[model samples]
Target chain A: MPPDAPAHLSEEQIISLVAYLAGGAGGDLAVGIGDDCAVLGGDQTGLVVTTDLLVQGSHFDLELMSPADVGHRSMAANLSDLAAMGARPAYGFLSLGMPARPTAAFVSELVGSMVAQGRAHGLKLAGGDTVKAPQVVINLCLLGAMGNLAPVLRSGGRLGDAVCVTGLLGGSGAGLAWLQAGRDPAEAAAAEAVAAHCRPTPRVAAGRALAESGRVHAMMDLSDGLAADLPRLARASGLGAAVEAEAVPISPAALAVAPALGGDALGWALGGGEDFELLFTCDPGEVPLLAQVVAEAAEGLTVTQVGRLTQGPGVTLIKQGEEEPITYKGFDHFQEPAP
Target chain B: MPPDAPAHLSEEQIISLVAYLAGGAGGDLAVGIGDDCAVLGGDQTGLVVTTDLLVQGSHFDLELMSPADVGHRSMAANLSDLAAMGARPAYGFLSLGMPARPTAAFVSELVGSMVAQGRAHGLKLAGGDTVKAPQVVINLCLLGAMGNLAPVLRSGGRLGDAVCVTGLLGGSGAGLAWLQAGRDPAEAAAAEAVAAHCRPTPRVAAGRALAESGRVHAMMDLSDGLAADLPRLARASGLGAAVEAEAVPISPAALAVAPALGGDALGWALGGGEDFELLFTCDPGEVPLLAQVVAEAAEGLTVTQVGRLTQGPGVTLIKQGEEEPITYKGFDHFQEPAP
Candidate 1:
């Protein structure tokens, strides 16, 4: 679930649920689901892994996607997590369940795109399992190497670190809005927004560059909207956050589409998740250098400071000098409308 | 898809389809989908990983299984794959899609069981993704360490190598037979078979032991039964295999229920998959020593030599001095009646 799953079974809940299982495991396991990717400790300390599932009619609408787009988006979701950890992508395993038997061509295109995505991201589509189900389900696991590199974890942020996000937000949400409204991208002004929602690019290069910069304190990808995801980063770091409402970078595409769809761009940027951009915290003085490094590493990318990790215990929003507790919750992507 | 899917889409096909993408990738990739697990190469050469998917009504029956059993069985499937490679289990990532909202107890039991199963197998349930779908879907990806352990590849067998398997076959299939026939184990004489079907064990300890013995040449688990799985091992080794029909070990439970079900125990042992037995080849002279090692390593486990790798081009079965090509196919666990 992404944001408003009702069952906000967040990483915190999952950890609490599995607390009984974590009591000393021969010292092999380190972190669980609280991080962007699981960090293997002790003997496997330098390895990080993550898995994400996409269900047809739940995470994606097959009607609006080409097989390639589905593959790309699914791959991107996992890749983004690995990126957040500053891990170098290595191997990928995919398991798929297709309820309907399309032509061999359809299967080929679908799988080919996955292979292409893996190759594009330096990930090898190494092994996978295929089964039958009631709908199209894709499960992807990526194993990455953090060897010889420092992992930027979500818990490392300092109370006074500047919270930053790379790239604009709300575009993906607006694209989804356009889609849900039955406006085809080809025939709608929200085509850019739809593309943003559909073809998310994992910030592998920028993440790696940021990690290498050694200035980043904590990092994660904004998949569940900035409003909900920022609090998670703050909580993970054992701190709170204060965001300037005006500092939230709304996407141009979202701005253009919101008026047409009668949607609020600010709300979408704050609460309409699915923007696969890197969110990090760093020393205030290093912000400019961090932005420059990411922009140079990955073309056309920008880093914006939206807030600061605060000493307080709850996230607050600064609107015209008024501080208000954040109340925006995101829908669980797993339970959400199709991307 | 498993053995008898009209569309086998075997690893060979999967590899062939991606050959274009595998041509040159900065020398990072070493292998693809043709083995029990993908062999990571280059900087991460000491690792092996595998993934498997289980779907409701396709791979398992909820009515016949407790959530714990489902979790264990799913874990066993992937563990068996890692075991085949002589890999040490490290981390596991799970992806689940639940169609209906079961009670909170159901969810806890399901996840807790997965955690328990991972703990029992020295695996850490590190991360996972959850979603809502029209039917239950489970995908597990396990990453293992081959460090300091020589991985037993399916292609390592030499001509005249003894073909062997761990434990009995056909019991799981018989168990499935009972379940599909609506015979509850509480009042059934095939209770052991039902137990076998519901709680198939992966031969991890024995597999690792075999790899340590350094005598076993090629290896794989019989997830798709002996008849179908043996040929895969043979093909991978660039050789053929010949099995003695009378030597194929049939489980006592399978034997006891075959007559009751009017089933041919031999046929089930050969083709009715889901046995989860490790099948391997070794130097004929090392059979006794290899068997003893595994027996010592994994109590109550036994390895038996059924035949030998041959120099021919295909698999053959000899019954009473007559040789015949094997034609008994297995239903893909991903396609057939639930296990």
Candidate 2:
């Protein structure tokens, strides 16, 4: 336990504590803890399973988002986990905790949005359980099938692997910041950020293409910003990473809001979360092949090489002529606001 | 929608609404909405999935049960769903919502109890997500596998199938009543009820035996009493049922507490929920073989024949010489209190 491991531990600390308590001795599971999804029965066709929770106030504020947006975002979060593993989305089970005496329209809208998203991703909502609570709680469990290949894992990167990210970063974080500032959503620059924050498109096609290329060695979705998540990938693979500050892609929306918040655009690009983009590692020689695979997928996505895995441990950043260690901190639920 | 459907719909009504919204047109699902677990594929080895939720005040009262008991019961609820499908328990994912600043001890206790139960039933706690909320909310998703046989579903019963229940009923409900009455747990009868309510066992071995014997046609866990759940099984199979009032298995603990609550033991036995016992349908001619199979499981569990499926549209209760249609009411979360 860390010095701050008390009643109000960070989300990462609590998850680590649980991982320790639940031991990594899964009998038939290929990958258990420290991965995006648990791999069950590692045959030609492996099953990858993941679960996510979206709570009222903590995950979404009803005042800011509609029920449909909440439903869609919750589905996207879980589907992104499957996409990280390069699995074909198959089945979904939802357990919803609703407020007492919720209206029929409320229930219908929530379920309809979830079903529509499921159909878009080829996932069928097969079963679910519901209960009345003080607020809305959406817990979705998704299952995906790995067809004729091993599901990609976070711990598969090598020392010489090139670190890359799919799509731009900082859009969702910028959107959240704009919303929190009580700004007009109709503002030209804020529109993109708000839309990205409300409805993130999971990089399913990009992830599948990367996984099928047989070049990508390790992969994971960026739910918790590149600065916080890249170190996790490094630690999992027992290596280190050196990210070039200039190479990190910053969205135009984030750039527009950076001056108003008195923060740099690059900071948001590195630390802002909920991007739902893929951060992966591959052999330096396979960059062109990986790009070709993404082109064939017709998703019009850009894969940017941001860093390289090193033989050392932990993550470092090269900004201008200075080199500094990157700290592991992001959008933790229990983390205190940084001044 | 029913005439009574409105803002304050009952739990069953809400579930029906969700099912309608989700739709039952599962392309590759062997069993979908109206079954204990959703069967993923119809091959020799099929995956069965189920999800359940335990809200703080709605599902369990902290004053009545310990954290460990709450954790144990939540796992039991999902395991029972897998048991109903005659599937081998495989993997589990738990998503927990905790109070904003919960004690470390509280989190540890809850997770420890869940992990212990998972190990006992050969289930591996693979992955999960946690969020902060107003109260503790537990949502568990379980996966099971049926080997070398098709998963038994609630729609498999025919008109001539006999309705049977494994183990006794009404114990958990009686236990809950005892606790709510502020009774002492030290009392012998109350102790049994309290134990049953706190740690109801899922009949996995019995379920496997019945499925292996190829005698059981339809099955589901009695989460919502015989009067309510039997109709569900019947409706799913496009059949009706006739239950004998005298044949319903009432526990001694329930009988002890019934008089104090101004109700009969049979009433508790008929209307109780959270029993976690298997209510299944089998061919009348195969009842003897099913009993023998249960005996071989060696838990000394009794398989009681309480009713039979009929070629009609609804359930009928045969009491003395009179017959009455059973009402579709049980422990609905949004239901009004009985006067």
Candidate 3:
């Protein structure tokens, strides 16, 4: 049978399902989502193109999500892809499907949030489409520039390069647990989790800074959790990696909230999704300078050296002086396992 | 409540909804709509973006349509938009939501038909997303280039210009009637009507020809049938039009089949929809030259001067020896009186 929704979910509820499934607009877009079409500004190195699809019941929960939050998330997802390629976003295209008669205000809120976010990041809203469907589906396309330099690819990480990440991780998974467990954590913690999920700040500045440093070997964003994404990066680079489990930074609030959900903060940090942080590999000698420059350039973002690339072809996770082989698996739309 | 569907309709039967919406992969699209994201092949003019949405039971009917035809028609609908603006079909991005496990092959055929049409016009299938939904929905974003020339706006037509059209009209409306009657005409006529419905060819080359000829004043594709669309062009261009009913070329086959279908051939020719033909205006002196060149360039296509632009506003129809206003209205998704 076709998926059945409530006879009448408020327009806001429907908007919440599709809006933040991708982040809203940014400064790069000239037109954004509300117009008949999005116009992209001209730039050097042509336009960087990328798209992603988010599915309801797979990528988000309408019951626990807000329309504004969904709007923010949709743009953020596309932005993260731009950040990974070391491209500065200029505009985006959004295509959404949901129930008919969704509130105009709800759609406006979603578009407004996207525009606000685009302005914050110097991205622009270019164009997109909207239609009625059973469940919510979102497709986001971002146009960016290669800037004055080349993009950092997953295949660029080299042996002996220091692997690192910007900012904390696991907060989103921990937050999700809190929501799922029926426990109302402190308002601050709840806010942090929701922020992580809804407004993941793509490391555009950090990525640009790292790309300019000329010392970084490769780069990517941490979205499908580290354990799943890191190995892909390593494999693409034709190398293996040894990660120090303890070196991975976890959100303090996530740590505090983990016990109540019967999960480990480390697991959340290593495997949590929706953490739109940068994970890059640089020369070990460049770590100190890299940290200082990245910190200054990215504001509150914290750069941490967490691992080292090796000659072999597998991931090794070090914990309490013991070594365990780490398997990499992230979110897959048609995959059987969520991890 | 949502619209009802015929019983015994399988999930695949429903997913045929978005089967045809092809996005324009403008001049610089590297990729679009079937992959991770649409890669823009950025150009000097940047990107001219446009999007449109089609919903099941709203824009089309599954009971009266084949999946492949639905798919082809939907894409043709959006391609018509790009043609209206004289944009080169470059790349397409699609976002579709439908009941899952729909025959993959059928989906492939629908998409393949799109790819075939795009290939015929030098476009690429970039990227898009698919998900499960009760009602099938299609969202198409077509990216094309403005070339070095500014886009020919809908409001560019002027007085005293000759209004011309490429190809005949009303075949799609006739095709719809045949489908409703549960009868498929002869293979030849069926092919013509089906082509009108399934793969209405967007007049990209013809539009570009008009735009580049330096003779055309304004242009738009006939989508909502000539009766409704002519006024839109006239309104946009701040001019009036006098369409000659006898001059409006009607297909001989459409005329032959009209009596049998208990319909007027003139009505279908004037008010039918989905003829993706270019309706352009040019100086009266340029009409002869344009007709010759467009005919030669768009081989197998006929270009005819069917009307004349007037100083005042609105549209008037002139029939043989009797020049009077014809109150001809075409299809409107929202304006259609409820059944």
Best by lDDT, which number? 2
* Candidate 2 or 1, higher lDDT: 2
- In Å, residue A28's CA in model 2 sits off its true spot by 0.6
Model 1 gets an lDDT of 0.81
Residue A331, candidate 3: Cα error in Å is 2.6
The docking category that best describes candidate 3 is: incorrect
- TM-scores of all predicted structures: 0.93, 0.94, 0.79
For model 2 chain A, give the 10-residue run with minimal summed lDDT. A330-339
Question: Considering every candidate listed, which one attains the maximal TM-score?
Answer: 2
lDDT of each: 0.81, 0.83, 0.66
What RMSD, rounded to one decimal, does every model reach?
3.7, 2.8, 9.9
Off by over 4 Å in 2: A1-9, A42-45, A260-263, A335-339, B1-9, B42-45, B259-263, B336-339
- Flag the better candidate by TM-score, 2 or 3: 2
Return the candidate ranking by TM-score, descending.
2, 1, 3
In candidate 2, what are the lDDT values of residues A27-116, reduced to their tens digit?
587777678998886321378889988878888888777788888888888889999999888888999988767788788777888888
Q: What's the distance in Å from true for residue B77, model 3?
A: 4.2
